[model samples]
Target: MSVPELETLLVADREQVRWITLNRPDRLNAISPAMLDELESVLTASADDPSVRVLVITGAGRAFCAGADLSPGPGDPDALPDVDLARSDAVFELLERQPQPVVAAVNGMACAGGLELLLCCDVVLAAAGVPIGDMHANAGLLPGAGGTYRLPRRVGLNPAMWLLLTGRTAPAEDFLRWGLVHRVVAAGELTAAAEELAKLLSGKSPLGLRRMKELVRDGLAQDRRTGLAHALAVAQAHQKSADYAEGVRAFAARRTPRFTGR
Candidate 1:
């Protein structure tokens, strides 16, 4: 559902997919401080809602996101007293930990914080020829919102360094080859393509997807053996779920399974 007060975001729910569009086309949908708070709020809500099986994060207009707004807005955390330093990065971390699988619909240019946003999501479907980069160096700023850590882990050290160092943009094709973007479609087809993917994900069992997401995200931090152990543990627990039983029954019955997210 759309929140009228959200100045920088346009949120809507179509079926089980929650589309969170960064609005501020005039500003190229830059991540202002207000935008970060709104994003955190929306993401938190989506994570809590059982009906929201998938999330598609995109931007309005020609650009996905141009990165952080250089001009500080009113009530900036840095300008406030007794500010929680950890709060700054918590928004980015929340996206990473969010249970729903996120699909980033990268359109136009996604740079700096935009790239950081992509790294948090599970998969990225970018518009063909869309350029993405970590251009913080050009702006005399370092990526403070989990970009440096997530970027390298996602695209390898050399490729990550190339973007972080050069402050130059590469076509979406480059990112797809680098294992960052999942797929690329034409600019006009981006929204429809993203919606198609979201709907595809929405048809699956929510509980199953959430647990699988947890496995992949958690396993990434552990050794192969430890990760395998964790996966087995998760699988053992999941076997007792109603969704699992329904899945088995539906397979035997040769029908589409109905999952209630249990």
Candidate 2:
């Protein structure tokens, strides 16, 4: 599918993997009103496009995203429109609910809202030497985009508490150790590594990937018995899909399965 023109986002599709780059390099890709609007529209469109099997989000310049644009451009008539921070929650929600897996490629600094944005992704890969932190505390504010809930789940409660309470930045390696990041690579290899992972994901059964994502995400909030029941129900339903029959036939034939995502 052809990508729509967007002022704040650069969209590219390669082998069923859609890469969305935050394009305001001068502002470190900070979240502005226009950027948020464009992002939401693009994400919504990508979700509905069956051709897009996976998505990777990254920034253009020195940072993945510095955070929200809170500074008013005083005396500058060309300033961006006032950002409605509340809309950020909706954007994050849209990302979480997408059928395709979303990966965050943190090329550099990811703080406050930027870090929160990464937390919404299913997989997170960061470049070495990148500084990551929750800076909401430093600004006398709290995370408004599911950070409080997602952070604790990504890292342990203690680490999440320390990061959120202090708003101190740490190296990407620290996050990798803390289990917040899936991989840490050299800055020059960040995009390549993310694309490699996206390519691998794009080759999987689209229905299987979507169902597995749903099972894990939704099961996390359920009791053990309830989670098991849901998993069984999902498995049973998947057995009736064409992909499952193809998988079985391929196993019997000793060949790779060609999943049509039916």
Candidate 3:
């Protein structure tokens, strides 16, 4: 189930980080069916491996992702297109469900489904001057991927509605103001910034980070009492882990801990 190197998406692992790059710079890194399938398979592979602690997704060149590849329109132009929107969503869900942290380094124009993809990331870093638009409405369409749902949750109801309804393009400043992007950096500094953050996060106990992501994501849907209860349970469980004991010992000795991800 490994992805062929020539596909529109490319995945590589370094240290504990799995770097995923959109390779179709010629088409603005548009996602094709093979690309979508490869993305899912690669994500699953990373999730299953304990050595992977973080996943960084970015584009090859100018654009992060221009959206789906509607060019060939799913093999045949005459037949009804079997566009698998579900497959796209499965990728999104994989991002949400993955135990490791996922960071999206938005290099350039992230519009339509591209913006949706950004929303799926736990943290999004955008390059300066990069513009993002939700062009579904302008093209007489709507977000099929988790855009309508995740966009509102990230940016708020009013702003999300306006963007989706008007299909307006937002600059990097606007994205920062709307809280869509976690950080914004100069164009050339994009990779460095994201890598710095990734390095910092990767230094932590892997299980702690995974549980934190799970708690926040799953706890949001519960009542306050239930959420707190779940948090306590998670804390108790972690306290019993080997990494937690090492963390305490390292703290008392005033030294950095080498976490084995127990």
Best by lDDT: 2
Single out the weakest 10-residue window by summed lDDT for candidate 1.
79-88
Instruction: Estimate the lDDT of model 2.
Output: 0.90
Model 1 clash pairs? Answer: none
TM-score: model 1 vs. ground truth: 0.93
Which parts of model 2 are misplaced by more than 4 Å? 1-4, 73-83
State the C-alpha lDDT per candidate.
0.88, 0.90, 0.86
The residue-by-residue lDDT of candidate 1 on 47-155, one tens digit each, is 8798899999998999999877765446785553332225547888899888988999997889988888888999899999988999989977788888889999998
Q: Could you estimate the TM-score for every candidate?
A: 0.93, 0.94, 0.94
For 1-262, candidate 3 gives per-residue lDDT tens digits of 2445546677777887888998999989877778888787888888878888899999998899888765755457767444578888888788778889999999999998788888888999999889997888986877888999899899999989989999998887788888988889999999899889888888899989988999999887999999999999999999999999999999999999989889
Off by over 4 Å in 3: 1-6, 74-82
lDDT (10s digit) by residue, model 2, range 1-262 = 4445789999988989999999999999999888888998888888889889999999998989988887767787678546566799899888888889999999989999899898889999999989999989997888988899899999889999999999999999989999989999998899899989998888788999999999998999999999999999999999999989998999999997888888
lDDT of 2 at 14: 90
Q: Residue-pair clashes per candidate, as listed?
A: 0, 0, 0
